[model samples]
Target: MKAILYLPLCMVLMSLNLAGQYAIDAAGSYVKNGAYSAAYSVGEVSTLTVRGVHSTYVSTSGVIQPDPLSITGTKNPGIATIRIYPNPVNDFLRLETDRTDLIQYVIYSMQGSFLAQGTVRGMSVQLDYLTPGMYLIKFSLVDFHESQSFLISKL
Candidate 1:
């Protein structure tokens, strides 16, 4: 008798949980569709307005969570498209690009000290002089106004 009653109670609780999952999924879809405001909290401690693409959260304790996308920022990834290989390079580092003309490169230490600067000679630039560590490479195309930064490793 008890086992039969227990089975129905368990089924009821499981069904409610499954329905809640569907409701949350639908709410997430609505959030992706348009800007909408929603808040949830345990008791009256904190109320967060996590709404749309630019949504954020805040608590009564004054803690806050900014929109994730804004935190990282954004960049064009322009010349970073070019292949730079033998990374952790021992000697020369190559900058392979279709338009090599008028290209200028400046290498800087991880600490922002100017290490090397020059035009692209062929496809590769010499890093034979640099001590093994990390460096930043800034590449610029004179007329094109195109620039990109690359974090490189040396060995």
Candidate 2:
């Protein structure tokens, strides 16, 4: 009957719509056992390369599907971990560190210009009055360095 045929067609269309909004699990997407375990949503006309923990995965959505490459012996050796919160920061940026011996932090513009530099203690720093732009924040200890790039939008 017409009703039975339409039901299957309608279900197929609904499934396609849901697939477009799929979100991959962030924690489970980590590299597993020296293999590429993450699923990235890439564009049909662009190429993407994900590099992490001494390994690299390259993919071209509409082209060739290649295996991820493993680069051994490039693991991060420093313990000076840095975390930034309120990612899409508005007026303030908070920083936390696992190492208490942090000596200082340096904020830089995307073009490598020094924006601000200062000492921090107790694992937190508040940044204010920053214009809308992208920045590279570097957390430093005696011989360890971890840099993260972030964006700030004032709206």
Instruction: Give the per-residue lDDT of model 1 (tens digit) for 11-65.
Output: 9988883533111111121112123333322233444466677776664322222
Encode model 2's per-residue lDDT on 78-143: one tens digit a residue: 655567777666656677666666467778887889888877655555566667767776666755
Supply candidate 2's per-residue lDDT for 9.
97
Q: Tell me each candidate's TM-score.
A: 0.47, 0.41
Top candidate by lDDT: 1
Name the runs in model 2 displaced over 4 angstroms. 1-78, 143-155
Candidate 2 at residue 74, lDDT?
Answer: 62
lDDT of each: 0.69, 0.62
